[model samples]
Target: MKYAVLIGDGMADYPIEKLGGKTILQAARTPAMDYIAAHGKAGYAKTIPEGFHPGSDVANMSILGYDPAVYYSGRAPLEAASMGVTLAPDDVAFRCNLVTIEHGRIKDYSAGHISSEEAKILIETLDAELGTDELSFYPGVSYRHLMVARKNLGAETECTPPHDITGKKIDKYLPRGKDGAFFSDRIKASMIVLELHPVNLKRIEEGKNPANSIWVWGQGHAPKFTPFQELYGKTGAVISAVDLLKGIGVYAGLDVIEVEGATGYLDTNYEGKVNAAIEALKTKDLVFIHVEAPDEAGHEGSIDKKLKAVEDFDSRIVAPILKHAQTSDEPFTILILPDHPTPISVKTHTQDPIPFAIYRTDNKESDEVQTFDEDSVKKGSLGLVKASDLIGMLVKAK
Candidate 1:
């Protein structure tokens, strides 16, 4: 049986008053998702484990059937894997973000989603000036970049995610604890180098948020993961625009498929991802398709954009995949859900359980849930399950 896992990243949300007290899932048009819920099993999954931050790295790891407590490392090492940056045993990887700071406040976490080209130039410049024998930087997608520190510097430091502290003062949130000074010093140095650079100057001229400083967080040493095929006995592929997801796929021994125009934003190429997934299923037993647009809109606290993202994901990604499974001769089991809740009210991730639906073409069993939404799925027969068990369920579905 073929398996498909569709993740609408950060698609879950709290009720918004602007949308008549309905969550984005409830307010948006998601016929394809609703159809899956109606014909199959709909329920909630605890994607975030207790005492763990609700980060995508942790959540997606769980969804991929690896317990975060056992195999999970920091977010950057995963991205480093995707970027082909090899990490030594004692080295730590950090997620380096180009952000906008205004009047001593964390103004924009993404620096207005700076283009990959401009970000590449800025990161390369930072590496030239600030990189030492102990520390180095590598550019990735958009404002997201990487910094590898030898000898495990700042591995035990407490650093805040820039998105978690948007618009807040950066003083209290700066890295603190063992070797924290090493990271904080470079962050300050980056501002001096980037603030007056030509890239920032050109961005400011265009009335856009300038990539003025680097915020480093999500640090860890490399992790060990059992290959997906060895663990589940199935060949698989992962398709996503985000480095974190691709990095996870890399560690899991899955094929990472890249699509043209697959930006981790609202303008990401939806059709391209869908096409890639369908093609992958021809040779692979399982395929994971992740969309980052909804989560990006959630972080920006844009209700209309999140609604559009949700609707677009359903119509563009889910509908086409479902159609392919129905028309194909081989039987298919499709699992649909989000990694976590980037609530519009909080503008950050919450550890709340996310709703999920599993539909099987070979065995079409109807559930009581008529639609796919937070409240509607509460009554599903599947009830609350562990996210780490989702892949097993999909694989075992008959």
Candidate 2:
């Protein structure tokens, strides 16, 4: 039997009241999703580490049937692969954002929501200035970039990232010592100068997307992981709209497939992305489908949009998969779950075990579990299973 994995990034983080006291699942009248939860067995699955910060990479890795402990690495390197910039063994790379620090404070951390067009030009300008033999800045998507430089020199420094929803993504950098302090100070100074650059000022005047500043956060270097092909037997592809996940797929030795016009925002084609994933599965053994719209909407605390994203996923990807199984006699195992909880309460990911349901080809009927949530899933027979073990559950079926 073939396998199909459906993953929603950071979808389970939000609680009912967390997103203004309404769960995206509850907020949206998702009849189809609700039906699946009611008709099939459901419960909370412990897919994350206890007390650890939740991230898309970690959660997805877990759900894709990898042990987070055995196959783990810094997130920046995964994202860096998408930018086509390999990090040096002695270089430290941080997932950066072009943010506006005004009056010794972060006014807008998303570099004023710079558009791709403007972001490209700004990167060119930074290249002219910040480009160096050692330190290199390569821009990714809006407000995302890579800050790479020689490691063990001034690289073990801390950044003032809005790691938490309440904390300003740019607060202050914590230095390990005078050297780190010096490095941070210079970086901050450079960012300050970048803000005042004439190129940015011109964009502001022209009402163009102006990414006139910079901030650094989520810093790290290359890390090691068990390659996907080496562990999962190689017949899998990662299909996602976001380049970061695509990049991770690329590095993990999984086939990375791109969708036509798959933007990261609401306007993206939900059906198109799902269809792309389905088509890829015909040629591959395992398919990792990453949907970012729910997480993005949850981050903005947009309950309506988050609900829309969830329903859209059910109607688009999940439904098609289910339909394919129903219409054909082919045996396949499908699992549906979220990477982590992205509770709308604070518009950030949380380290809570998410709800999930799995359907195998052998089961006479789905389990008697009902509802999918942190609490609901705990009542199931398979209690709090690890991500790595999910493969065994499906692979052993039928």
Candidate 3:
């Protein structure tokens, strides 16, 4: 049997009054997703375990069948793995984001989604100036970057994610706890280094948000993961534009498929991702396709964009893959869900049970759910299942 998992990252949302009190999923036209819910099984899955933060790293790890309480070390280490930056036992990898600070307040988390080309230059410059044997910076994609500190410089430090503090004063949210002052110092140093840099000047000239500072958080050492094949008895591949998902696949021993033009934004190449998944299924038993646009839109609190993203995902990604699975000779099981809820109202990740749908070509038995949305799936036959256990159900584990 073949398997496909489609993740619309942070796609779930609370009802928006502007959208007529309907959630983005309910407002968007998602016939493909609805078809799966109508023809198969649908329910809610608690992707984030109790006492865990509602971060994508933990949620996706759970979806991929690894209990976060067991395998999750930190978000940055996963991104580091995807970037091919091996972490030593004593090294702590941090997720470094190029951010925009205005008037001592956190203005933007993503620095207006600064171009990777521009970010690379800024990252290299930071490494040149601030990097020493104990601290180093590595560029990944866009505003997302990495900093590896030797001897766990800030392993115990508590730093808030920049996205969570948008529009808030930086002083209250600055890194705290052990060695947090060290991270705060670097953040201040970055503001000085980047405020007048060529890239920031150019961006300012163009009426764009300047990446004027670096925010470091999500630090941890490397984590050990059992190969996907060893755990599930199936070879798999993962396709995503974000480094974190790719890193998870790297550690899980899944093929990390890189598609041209696949950005982790609304402009990402959806066609290329679907095509890659179809091709990967030729050799692999399962393929995981993740799209980040919905999550980005949720972060921006743009209802229209989130609606467009959800509709595009339904039409461009899900429809094509589902058509292929239906036409293929081999039986295929396809699962669709979000890693976590980046609610439009909250504008951040929330520990909510996300709705999921699973369709099988072999067995057409379905549940009461006829649509794919937060509320519609509650009546599904599958009911509520643990995110980590979904894989076992998909693989029909004995």
Candidate 4:
């Protein structure tokens, strides 16, 4: 038997008035997702535990069957794992983002989705100038980067995610608490270097958002986890474009499959990811496929783009995987869901239970749910299951 867990990151949303008071999922044409709900079991899953921020690191960890409370050390450490940045016992990792600040306000978290090629040069320059014996910078995909601080410097400082502070002032959001001054000074110094760099100048010429500064947050020590195969007895692989998901796969002892042109945005290669998952499942017992485009659309607070992202995910990514699974000789169980709700109104992640659907090749039993939206899935049989239970359920499915 084979298992596949598909995640449309931040795909859940609140009802938008522009879409006739329908959520993006309801407004979008998601035939493949709707079919799963119509023919399989659908319900809500609490991916975000109480008292935890609804970040992808914590949410995806839960979705992959690990308890965040037990295993989540920090977001950067996970990305560090993906970047092959080894962390010592006392080493702390920070998520360093090349962000855009305008008139003291946080304008864009992704700095207009700066290309990795451009971002690499910027981060390397920051490391050479600002890096000390205690702190250093490592570049990852696009806007997501990393800073490792040895001896636990600034590990306890309170920092805010740049994406969460979009359109808000940076004064109150700057890193605070112990070692806050250290992080704040470095972050401020980054602007001087970045603002004058040729990269930012070129970006300005192109009318793109310049990565004028660095915002470091999500700090913690390394984490430990029980390997996926050891815990579930299933050899698995993970397919994603973002470092966080790939890092989670690394800690969980799963193969991380990278696809060309797999950007973590609307233009991401959906076909490549779909094909990767199908190929992985041919030899691996489980595959976790994640798409980040919907989340990016939600963060930008664009209802139309969010609709397009969801529809594209349904038609392009989900449909092909399901088709391949159906034609294969081995039986399969597929589970689909989002990490959390990045509501269009708020333009940030919320701690909301997301709708999910589970389909089995052999069993066609389903509930009254005919669609795969937040409201429609409330009628499903598996009401309000914990995210950690999802893997076990999928593995045990008949």
Q: Judge candidate 2 at residue 343 and give its lDDT.
A: 73
**How many clashes would you count in candidate 2?**
17
Per-residue lDDT of 111 in model 2: 56
Per-residue lDDT of 228-276 in model 1, one digit per residue for the tens? 9999999999999999999999999999999999999999999999999
Q: Which stretches of candidate 1 lie over 4 Å from their true place?
A: none
Candidate 1 or 2, higher TM-score? 1
Q: Across residues 258-338, which tens digit of lDDT does each residue of candidate 4 receive?
A: 999999999999999988888888789999999999999999998888888999999998898888778879887889899
Supply every candidate's count of residue pairs whose N, Cα or C atoms clash at under 3 angstroms: 0, 17, 0, 0
lDDT of 2 by residue, 1-398 (tens): 66678876766754565446555665555554455555555656666676444777677767766666765656677788777887778877777666656555555556545666667666666767776776677867766777776754445565545434233543344344535665566456667557767767876798654454565655566666667767756478887776668767777778887777666666666777777777876877777777877887777666777878887877887778777755546666677888887777777777777877776554546565665555556676666777767766666555
lDDT of each prediction vs. the true structure?
A: 0.94, 0.67, 0.94, 0.92
Against the true structure, candidate 3 reaches a TM-score of 0.99
After superposing candidate 3, which stretches have Cα over 4 Å from the reference?
none
Query: What does the lDDT read for residue 331 in candidate 4?
Result: 82
lDDT for each residue of candidate 3 in 117-192, tens digit (9 for 90 to 100): 9999999999999999999999999999999999978989998988888888999899899999998999999999
Among all windows of 10 consecutive residues in model 3, the one with the lowest summed lDDT is: 389-398
